[model samples]
Each structure stands twice: as C-alpha cells, then as structure tokens.
Target: MIIRKATHTDIPSLVILMNNFRKFYQQESNTEEVKSFLKERMDKGNSVIFVAILEDKLVGYTQLFPSFSTIKLEKIWILNDLFISEKFRGLGVASQLLTRVLKFSQETHRHQVWLLTGNDNKSAQHLYRKIGFTNTKFKHYVYNF
Candidate 1:
C-alpha cells in the first residue's frame, strides 16, 4: 500500500470514496455535487487531502482543513474526513493516512489537529486513541442555518 497527497488526477476515485463516506454518515449521495465540491477545494488549495493506494487502486483517503486557534495563537488543522473502503478496513490503511496527516501538520508547524467522530463509531475512536489522540473535556456545538 502507498500513501500520498492527492492530486487532480485523483478526484474521480476520491469522489467514490467520499460518497461512500457520506453514505456511512447517512448523508444523501450526489455525485455531481461531490465532484464540484472536491474540484473547488482542490483548485483553491483550501484543504489538504491524502490518498492511500493499494495495488494501483485508491483504497482510502483523509482530508484536513486549515483553521486558526485563537487560544494558541497559531494555525491548526481540522481532520474533517477519513474513509477506507470496506474491503480495506482493518489493514492499517486508516492509520497510514492519519500518520501522513500528522506528519504534514508537524512539518508545517501547526499547533494541533482536531477531529470529531460519532459516539457510535467505536472502530474509529479506537484507532484515534491508539494514535495518541485524547478525548477533550470541552463540548462541541454547531448551529445549522
């Protein structure tokens, strides 16, 4: 398996994986919208995406968006998305992708990386804890428009 940053050439395969990810979260599937959203992010360089390829096939991916931490007075990363194909699960693909993200964050001198997962996602929570991420005391809240 190989882990690397995603390029424009990767958008097609990425769309499939991203759609699957959304489906897992009970979101509606819209390939056209997914394509457009990914294209915009890639074209604008607004986010960092990494892909995992196994035997020449895209098997997994993770995406991170840049943000600032006012308390730390430094840049931080929101690890927004991570998904491994069902067949590729438990093969350490997710770990490899996350390792790459953390390495990139360190290289860029970011203050920290933050991510949230549903309480029911035990597998993901386990992997994240194994990777040295700790549960925070603060609660997260969002107001939908």
Candidate 2:
C-alpha cells in the first residue's frame, strides 16, 4: 500500500472516489462533475487531497480545505472529506490517509485540523479515535441559506 498527496494527474481517479463518497452521504453526483470541480480547485490551490493506492490501484482518499482561525491566528485545515472504497474498507487506507494529513499539518505548521462525522458512524468514530483525535469537543453550528 502507498499513500501520498494527490496531483493533477491523479484527479480522474480522485474524482471517481469522491463521487462514491458523495453517494455514501446520499448525494447523487457525477464523476465528471467531481473531476471538473477538483480540477478547478487544483488550479486555484483551494484544497489538499491525499490518496491511498495498492498495487497501482487507487483505493481511498481524504481531502482538506485550508481555512483560517482567528483565535489561533494560524491556518486551519478542515478535513472536508474522507473515503475508502468499499473494496478497501477493511484495509488500512483511511488510517494511512489520516496519518498523512496529520503529518502534512505538522510539516506545514498549520494551526490545527478537524473533521466531523455522523454520530452513528461508529466505524469512522473508531478510526478517528484510533488515529488519536480525542477530546475534541468542538461543535458544528451551520446555517446554510
């Protein structure tokens, strides 16, 4: 298994995996649409993505958006997306991707990183805990209009 930050050439596979991730959240998104969105983001330096591969096949990925925290007076990384393909769920793909994210944060000297997952997703919660994200009592209050 190999894990690394994604590049423009990896966009196609990344998009497909992102579409699957959306479907898991009940969103009906197309791969082409995802690809286009990702392409624009890449060109604009809007976000970061890390992909996990096995035997030359893309298996999973995690994406983070660079944001700022006034309180910390530093950059904040919103761990926006994480998806391990169905075929790779039992493997260590998600763990590896998250490790990469944390390492990236440390290397970049970012303020901090955070992610939100549904309360019922016990498996994901377990993974997050196993990865050492504990005691993060941060609450999400979103008002989308």
Best prediction by lDDT: 1
Report lDDT per candidate.
0.96, 0.88
Model 2 misplaced regions, further than 4 Å: none
TM-score of 1: 0.98
Predicted candidate 2 versus true structure: per-residue lDDT over 67-100, tens digit per residue: 8888779888999999998988888888889889
Residue 31 CA error for candidate 2 (Å)? 2.2
Worst 10 residues of 1 by lDDT: 110-119
Error of 1 at 37 (Å): 0.4
- TM-score of predicted structure 2: 0.92
Q: Per-residue alpha-carbon lDDT of model 1 for 30-112, expressed as tens digits?
A: 99999999999999999999999997999999999999989889999999999999998999999999999999999999979
User: Taking the candidates one at a time, how many backbone clashes does each contain?
Assistant: 0, 0
TM-scores of the models, in the given order?
0.98, 0.92
Quote the lDDT for 61 in model 1: 95
